[model samples]
Target: MLRFKELVLTMQEFFYFALRAFATLPKAKRYWRDVLDQAFICGVESIPIVLVSSISIGALMSMEVGNLLEEFGAKTMLGRSTSNAVLRELGPLLMGLMLSARYGARNGAELGAMQISEQIDALRAFGTDPIAKLVMPRLLAALIMFVPLIALSDFAGLQTGALVAQYYHKLDPGIFWNSIYPRLLPMDFVVSFLKAPVFAIIITLVSSFNGFSARGGTAGVGRSTIKGIVASSGLVLVANFYVSKLVFDIMH
Candidate 1:
C-alpha cells in the first residue's frame, strides 16, 4: 500500500513537472543557449556510442536472421528480417535503454547535486524559475535530439544489416535491398520515429522528478540517480509496448 502510494505520488510529480515544462516552451527561446548546450550533451555526446552500438547490433542481428532464414534456403529474406526487427523493435528499445542510462542518469545526478549544494534554492531565492532555466531546456533538448538520434540509429542498423548480409550470408546486395524495401512499409519508418519522442519525454521527466525530489545530501543524490535510471528504464519498456500498439492500429 505504501509502495503504491509512493508510485502514485511519483506519477503525479512527473505529469506536473512535464506540464510546466511544456507550458514554458514558448518562452524557451530565451533559454536558447542552455537548450543548445543540453542538445550537445544529449545529442552530440551520445552519437559515438549510439552509432557504434547500433551498427554492431544490426550486424549481429543480421547473422542471427541469416542463420534462421538459411534453414529454409531463404537467404534473401535476411534484409527484411533484420530491418523489421531493428526498426520496429530492437533499435528504438536499445537506444532508449542506453539513453536512460546515459542521459537520464546524468540529468538526475546533475540536478540532485545542485539540490544538495543549495543551488536550486539559490535560484529560487533569486526569482529564477529553475524548471524553466534548468529542467525545461534539458526536456526540450531531449525531445528534439531523440528524433535525429533514432533516425541515425535506424539508418546505421539498416546499412550494417545490408553489409552483413552481403559479406557473411553471401546474399547479393540487390536482393537484400529488394527484400527490405518491398517488405517494410512507409508506416514502419513513421512509427519508429514517433516512438523516439515519447521515449524522450519519459527519460527527461522521470529523471527530473527524481532530481527534484532528492534529499539526504550527497547520499541522496546517489540514490536518486539509481532510482531514476531504474524507473526511467522500466517506463521506457512499458511506453514502447503501448506506443507500438497504437502505431500498429493507426497504420493498419
Candidate 2:
C-alpha cells in the first residue's frame, strides 16, 4: 500500500511535469537556440547508432527469412516479407529503442546533473521557467527530429535488406525491389512514420521527468539516468505494439 501510494504520487507529479512541458511549447521561440542544440544532440548525433541497429536488423531479417522462405520455394516473396517487416515494424521499433537509450539517457543524465548541481534551482530562483527553457526545447527537438530519423531508418534498413537479399540469397535486385514497391501500401508507411512522434514524446518526457526528480547527488544522477533509459525503452516497446495494433485496426 505504501509503494502503491508512492507510485500514485509519482504518476501525479509526472502528469503535471509533462503537462508543463507541453504547455510551454509556445515558449519555443524564446529558446530557439537551445532547441537547435537539442536537435543536434538527439537527432544528428543519433544517426550513427540508429543506422547501425537498423542495418544489422535488416540484414539479419533478410538472411534468416530468406533462408526460411527458400525452404518452401517462396524466395520470390522475400522482398515483400522483408519489406513489411523492416518498414512497418522493425525499422521504427529499433529506431525508438536506440533513441530511447541514446537520447533518453542523455536527457536524463544531463538534466539529472543539472538538478543535482542546483542549476535548475538557480534557474527557478531567477524566475525562469526551467521546463520552458530546458525540457520544452528537448521535447520540441525530439518531436521534430524523430520523423526524419524514422525515415532514414526505413531507407537504410530496406537498402541493406535488398543488398542481403541479392548477395546472401542470390536474388536479383530488380526482382526484390519490384516485389516490394508494388505490394507497399500507405498503411505500411503510416505505421512506420506515425511512431516517430509517439516515441519522441515517450522518450523525451519520461527522461526529463526522471531527471527533474533526481536526488542523492552523483549516484542519484546515475540511478535517474538508468531509470529513464529502462523506462523509456520499455515504454517504446509497448507503444510500438499498441500503435501498430491501433493503426491496423482502424485502417484494415
Candidate 3:
C-alpha cells in the first residue's frame, strides 16, 4: 500500500511538474541559441558512437537470428527478425541507454555542481531564469538529439546484422542483402527515428531537473546520477512499447 501510494504521488508530481515546465517555456524563448548549442553537444557529438553501435548491433542481431534459423532452414528470415528487432526495439533502446549514461550522468553532475557551488542561485540573483536558460536548453537539445541518434543506431545495427549474417552465419552476402531489402523501407526508418526525440526530451528534462533539485551534498550527486540513468532508461523502455504500438498500428 505504501509503495502504491508513493507511486501515485510520484505520478502526480511528474504530471504537475511537467505542466509547470510547459508553462515556463515562453520565458525561456530568448535562450534558443543556448539550447541549440547544448543540443549539438549532447546530441550531435554522440553521433559517432550511436552510428557505430547501431550498425554493429544490426550485424550481431542478424547473426543471432541466422543461428536460430539455420536449424529450420529459414536463414532468409534473419533479415526480418533482425530488422524488426532494430526497428521495434534495439534502435531506440540502445540510443536511450547511451544517452542516459553519457548525457544523463553529465547533466546531473553539472547541475549538481552548480547547485552546490551556488552558481544556480547566482544566476537567479542576476535576474536570469535559470530553469529557462539551463534546463530548457538541455530539454530542447534532448528532443533534437534523440531521433537522429536513434536513426543512426538503427541503420548501423541493421548493417551490422547483415554483416554477421554474411560472415559468421555463413550466408552469401548477396542473398543476405536481398533478403534484408524487402524488410525495410524509408517509412520504417522514419518511425524508428521518431521515437528518439521523445526519449531524448524525457531523459534530458528528467536528468536536468533531478540535478538542479538535488540536495545532500556529495552523496546527492551520486544519487542523482543513478536516479537519472534509471529514470531515463525505464522511461525509454516503457515509452518504446507504446510508441511502437502506435506507429505500427498507424502504418499498417
- The Cα error of candidate 2 at residue 168, in Å, is 0.9
lDDT of 3 by residue, 64-150 (tens): 778789989998777778887888688878888778888888898899888878899999999987777787777767776676677
lDDT of 1: 0.91
Q: Native-vs-model 2 lDDT?
A: 0.95
What would the per-residue lDDT of candidate 2 be over residues 72-190, giving only the tens digit for each residue?
A: 99999999999999999999999999999899999999999999999999999999999999899999999999999999999999899999999999999999999999888999999
Best by lDDT: 2
Output the worst ten-in-a-row residue range by lDDT, candidate 2. Answer: 175-184
Candidate 1 weakest lDDT stretch, 10 residues: 182-191
Query: Candidate 1 residues 49-121, lDDT tens each?
Result: 8888799899999999899999999887888888888998888988899999999999999999999899999
Select the stronger candidate by lDDT from 2 and 3.
2
- What does the lDDT read for residue 97 in candidate 2? 94
Regions of candidate 3 where Cα sits further than 4 Å from its true position: 1-13, 24-29, 185-187
